[model samples]
Target: MKYYKLGIVALSSSLVLGGIAPIAYAETSIPTNVLAAKTTTSEVMDKERLIERVHELFPGMFEDVREEEFRFDSGRSYGEESELESYGLRFFKELSSDMYVSGRFSFVGENLELVYYSYNNENNEEALFPPQVSKEDAEKIAVSFLNRMTNGSDYQLADNDDELYFYDNQTLTEPVEYNFRFDKVVNDVPVPDQSIRIEVLGSGVVSYYFNELTGKQEVFEKKESLLTESEALDRLKEASNVELQYQIQYERSDDVKAVLTYLPSPKIDGIHGMTGQYYIAGELLDKLPKKEKLKVLSSTPVEKTASITKKEAKEMAEQLLMPKNDFVKLNIEGVNERENYRGQRVYDVEFMYETRNGGSGSSIEIDVDTGELIDYRGGFDERFLGEEDSSRPLAYKNALNKAVDYVEKYASSYVHEVAYPNESDNRQNRYDSDDEEYRFYFPRVKDGTIVNGNGIRVSIAGDGELLGFSIDFDQISDWPSLSEVVSKEEALKDYKDVLQTELQYVSNNNQNEYQANHYKLIYTGEMDKEVLRKYYDAQTGEWTAASSRYDSGKQPSDVTIEHPWAEEELNFMIQAGIIEVENPETFNPDAVITKGDALKVLSKSLSRYYRYERYDYEEQKRQTFKNIDTDHDLYGMIELAIDRGVLEADTENFPLDETITREELAVWYGRILKLTNVADHYEIYKLNMKDSEQVEKANVGYVALVGALEIMTPNEDGYYLPDEEVTLAQLALSNMRLAQEMAEMDIDYR
Candidate 1:
């Protein structure tokens, strides 16, 4: 067995048998001979106290340990070096040759506090199956352990959908663990940045824990001087504006439609209730500057065809991304063709910077057909230059101009389709001050309306050099008519009617440094409420929720609770997102299911590709049946079934809407089990049942296999009703049984 080092820490001292070595310390706390003489007694006592704390947390697990030296620079300077005793410390112990436990602690004033802890028992055989504790019990253990922390009383359990310990599709061989997040609140107002995350294993052990709580003091806005809720809403309404745009409805179909939406303005994030001013990145602004539109870079159209060779594309990349320093050269690694997110074929050129360390590299993507620069991100890090210069950085306006110039030089053929950037597009607060890079987004325009899903993003470094560029344009031919849409006023009114707000303490500029940052009390929409998060559909004059695989409150109806047989299986399928419930109140499980609906559920439950989004460009255009075109609702699922050999396109047009029979289901199950050859030879199998003659001769082997495997059983009277129509409930129960048998047989359909 090979032992692995877990973190990026320097090895300074040898492994100690009983306890940590006296000289073992973090790099930031390294002491010279003179400094050691002055602080030896105090430092030794602090180290002993921290070691005792670790032993108390994980008793008897870390006796034989080694110290790893790491640097923790908070970017704050103390007056003198002798004033600060230590900064951070890390220690690990080998439980076995291949398993270990580690803990990281930081010095807070006079005491050492644990910042992170982990137990590397992920591959242990004992943790793989048959979880000893339930998720509810594990959650209780987590909460009990959290209450012993220093700031435990200030935190509350976070309400999110990520708290599930196991998913329906998860295999039984995978380890079971519960994850919980607790958010720190100030005077009952939740702070988004300060939180603690804890992971509890199946054995009810706290396996990992990390906290983002800071030590620095902070100032918060006074709530006593705030305005009323109605007053804040009025200010938000005054600042909000509606715009007409083209939104691609990918969930329904690949169709672009004109929509009048009231999207939250990028200039304003929230309203400050204290002063009735707009909050833009935590700064109060009396009013926003006038919005400006970007002018088209070119007026001429370019041909969309393969005009350049592979060698020419490589040459273009070298010409555009060549470094300024002669010693550092751009080495072309290789080139490959792949489909981008928008289903466009492009050539990805990967290259590396031949620097001293020999690891930093980036890639550039170009359109193979039009030979346009689709994506490129190249810049020189300060460390790569072997020296640092104290030169001043370029102004924001100068950097913007440099970015525009680079785009025009490399992507002029496609630049005419995108609108140019304005002043508000500058993302100054999103990056660090030392490595600040300005990003600008230019939206694509269609018939004078912006395309929400299509845009071009450009990033320029502080030294006026191109850092990154990418274009996201889809080939859409049909667009809805804009003349018949509702007015912008009506759309805005509809949004305001459903909008609701709650007060919370938010960090300035959305920074994660909670202790050193300032916060303000603001009224904003509750993100957890789905009804308040929808947009008004201008064409239909109705509100439509965001596209998701499953909607909130879309569980099986109350009628399922009284189900005599398939209550659990029906609820499981619905919760797993395999079966969509159109009407949660009236989900009649007894209704007969069509061939298309049955195939959809089976394909999604067995194949991982059908459940998730596929970016394979070739599969996007392929069709298996004549009736199930690319535009059909069940095209992808049907194709997945055909590919998996569960169904075949033996006929030109499949009867998608026809009701399925019991014999048909058995045939599908037999194919899934890879017994097709045996099932095809029906003459070799004999059926012994009351209605044995009712089974077709061609389906005798299929029915025999399903009955023997217990995937689908006969009726109470031992009568095989092969010609009866299968109901939704009957399919649900049988599919689950088939899945269990597949797992037992070690057959991985996914």
Candidate 2:
């Protein structure tokens, strides 16, 4: 089995295993209470002092340490003094054993703090698989470590919705790591923006920690002066508004359902606890404007076909992104045709510019069918220009007009389906004095209701220049009718049923500034019980979580919780997002497994490309089987299996729904192991089973190979059961073993 190395090191310098660099610490002395003190002035520490501070944090971990100089600047010329020079100090050390540790220190106020640290060891062979420590135990370790830090008592553990045992490129051999985030609290209310994250390995070891709490002192609104919870809830109700939207819901089947749901308007985010006012775009408001009416860009829909050539698309991109200045030279790097998520074929044009100092580049996309510009983002750096503009920035209204004009000129063909957003729909603080750019979204309207997730986003710079533009239009043929939907008032009542609030100290300050100017006491919607946040079905007038609609097929069945045989493997597959069952609540482990379903699980285990896409199969180009066309739900997985050589496409049609046999599964595993040639020569293999004669002549080698590899085993009677129907539980255990064997052999199907 392959073990994954897990560690995080924050440094620009490379790591080299060697002895410690001798440094004299007698010249510079740091205060013992420096780390715990909250000083006002900035303090610069020497190399020796920084090393001493690191040792204090993780005592005896960095005995053989080496110091390295790490410097950085904000687009400034070389040889200039920068703030990073005083704060960013890196150190590395290799222990006498196979363990290695590295850490960095930064000056937070006048105190030196360890900003980042990583500990890794080569002898991870004994690391327990599936994690020995549970999430509950890991949380205890994280909280204990946090409480040991200065002012850590002021923080509370925040809710984490991430999977408990999953990691990127995770294998069964790697130990599990649990990550937690703790938010700082003021007056018993959480400051959502201020948080410290900690990651604990399954071995009860704190592998990583990050403290985002700034050194700058913050002032918060007095909690005593805040309005009561009931008053705040009433204010929220008055400010809240609900709208009808048609959402495309992708299920485990091929058919896509259009869900008409009552979704809350994105206008009101929170209610000020002290003033009983609505907070929109970080600004309090007495009332919100009326919802905007649909304003279609054109009366007729544009022609949708792949009519534009690569040369034509490149020319269009050059016309839009290439600046009309002679000071810089722009070159077209390449152009490629690709299908987008929405099943729209488009041309991606890549280009770059050369300036005297340096160069930057960006790409744009154009719909191949309509020959209309779909996306573009362009901005020239001011430093590369000749002189700075003396004129003032464009007003919000003027910048918006510029964006509208550009969209009308470039993407006019496809604009008929989208409607301009309401003035109140601009979720940003447009009235703010420091606001720079204006972002606008034109949502797709159908049957006089917005299609919540489909829209076009356009961004306009403060100087009235087109900064970015992108169009997202799904090929939706059927839209649910709104005639039988519940009344808006009834839907609003249903929304209020599950609506809950929590007090939080919110900050509207710029993120670049470490210190917040001030924090406001606000009551924000907190639906802690519901995973879907806030969504009400218009037809049923019932609240629903996103899992009910999208993840019903992926959720583990209750019956698999304590099964005698396949519970652990089935649960692992579900947690890893490898297998999908039709009815998760009542998944029958003993049911005969379908050929297509078994192939999907095998492909997902071996191939990285076997991913579930809502609209991916609609645009799939390969059809490995006559029955499994682009319209089939598992078309992509079948094609991926064919590509990986696990499934042969020699047959005209695949029996997707047919019951798979044990011997058939063995053949697929043989192909996955790249032993198909040896399996074909059945005479060269010997079968040591009591029912060896029952196995087919052509499948004897495959059955023998799997039994030898221990991916599959015979019964206690020494019968291979080659002709038996493969059950869900049997397949789950075999797939797990197959994955482990593939990892051991270093076979990467990806």
Candidate 3:
């Protein structure tokens, strides 16, 4: 989140209350057509004429303040309603430059009121006081109050994080409108740049926002808000229990009003509670030439949209307002909130539902503005079972019980909600990084509300643990499941097809003849004992597998496996760092290495060792392979190797699928290395005059390779037998060494 390449901009709501008043017009001057007769070019006269024109359009509608018969001189107002006609207002007088004196005024038939918006900063937002502290004392006391009383004792900078600074104190002028936003740098160093503030909450968070560049508004999502299911609930609970507080720290000019629209509102139900008041904002402008929020506001009722039956539009908005999960149902009744998108008023929707999953079904959450899919739980429960079993979604009680017990022991206080019989699928065979394994979701206990945010995921249906869990430590959740991106069935199909072409193979994870779905998606490299050992030793993730012995488990999915390749170069790459060799003990040999992965290895190899004076042509290199191109990032680097004659290709093309071996690579390297060498490394070798009978007579080139590197030798079988195909791991290890020798920088542009 340092640079937040995955910028989540959002749109939010603003309170523009009520029906439009008729615009007033006056006619004291002649029309523009009549004015055309004037020959005078007086600047002062022009200004007068413009004023007249404006008055003719919206006369008496003062530009100074906008409210129905109400003046906005001080830029502040406070009051809220629980229902219609239940209105109240709070007015304030300047108590000091830093504070204002305000009174809670309500019209409950005559001056009846409640003391709210009293003296207190965020974290104390809900701090209510007795009637004694009049609007005067509240505003006066607030101005003199120190922030140390409110912020945490060990307050650390959310901005410029390494620097230990916290909210020592801050004062908010009435809600003000700012034209732009500012940004912070590498260490969260504050930098004044163009950014629109939908609403600023406290010092470090914005309620809603839109990237000026992309025009996408992502609401309620604060910077780095992602967290584990556990962390998410924990935050929500705390927020609900107490009134939240925040401040705006950036510098703004006197002409600009600093209105912070974002304040996380915490609500509570009888025993359980959910406490996250997020925001939805409008879209931003193009190309951030200035630091500011979007200027356009929509009040128009769409003509086309209006043409649709109001019922249909209402239904669209209702569904959009809720998360799309089949397990939960929703009943929405829209209220006249404030303003709408086209020409209608945005509805204040009231809803309720039941979680069919039988657990504490949380809210049917949806995106604030454009209701889009986020997360869901209810109605349905799933777990791994035999592929051909007649029964499905079976209720496995014992396993669910154990998992909850395990979680409660290590993480009861922060635990959100535990899913029973979570579903899992492996999709690495199609989209590697998008591989999702488990469907288990956990919640964070916040203010008693078990809200889902972030957590660890494991597949209990089998012995395997897809991953131990962790989450970003904030209100947001991480993108744990890639089920949507890579099609699981498709990836497995690809895996089956590749391995089927190989000689007779055995699918080892499950008992004899297990099906493909039972494989439980895994990284191709996870099979290596060294890598697996390291994975567990480092405690990098949770340690569970479908079967510990790999020979006794039972499942019904169809899967075909082939033995690992024997190529030394490939094996070296795996060891050195260029590629992964196995997902488990099995290696599906016939599987075609992806064009993306192939270039990744080669580019990674070159990237480690050398920095070219210039990057080779990006466009041209992609043209080197018939099956690949420069449009792909690998294009330039691959072409660079080819043009330098450092790569070997058949006549006109580089066959991307063929496996490479050590001897072949070494032989190839011998020629390239000699271009700068004073004497040929091949000089020490004599054709057919074998040093060891195991050396193939047909491999004089390999003999020369062995002499040049001097790393390997004849083994117990007495063979340097050079023609064997290389494994991905071997290729990785060699490339890693090459990279180390080159000593390239590891910083990434992204």
Q: By summed lDDT, which 10 consecutive residues of candidate 1 come out lowest?
A: 6-15
Clashing pairs in 1: none
Model 1 C-alpha lDDT per residue in residues 641-745, reported as the tens digit of each score: 777688887999879889999989999988876666656777867775788899888888888877767777688998888889999899888887676555443
Worst 10 residues of 3 by lDDT: 9-18
State the lDDT of candidate 2 residue by residue for 149-234, as single tens digits.
54445988897653232211234434456788888888899997777778787677776666654434468888778787888887
Clashes of 2: 1
TM values, all candidates: 0.73, 0.79, 0.25
C-alpha lDDT (0 to 100) for residue 576 of candidate 1: 53
Model 3 Cα shift for residue 208 (angstroms): 38
Best by lDDT: 2
Q: What would the C-alpha RMSD of candidate 1 be, to one decimal place?
A: 10.7
- After superposition, which runs of candidate 3 have C-alpha atoms over 4 Å from their true positions? 1-235, 238-577, 580-599, 606-616, 619-622, 648-650, 671-684, 687-706, 712-718, 736-750
Tens digit per residue, CA lDDT, model 3, 514-600:
122111111011122212211111111222222111121111212333335434334333433334444635654344344345556
Please rank every candidate by lDDT, starting with the best. Answer: 2, 1, 3
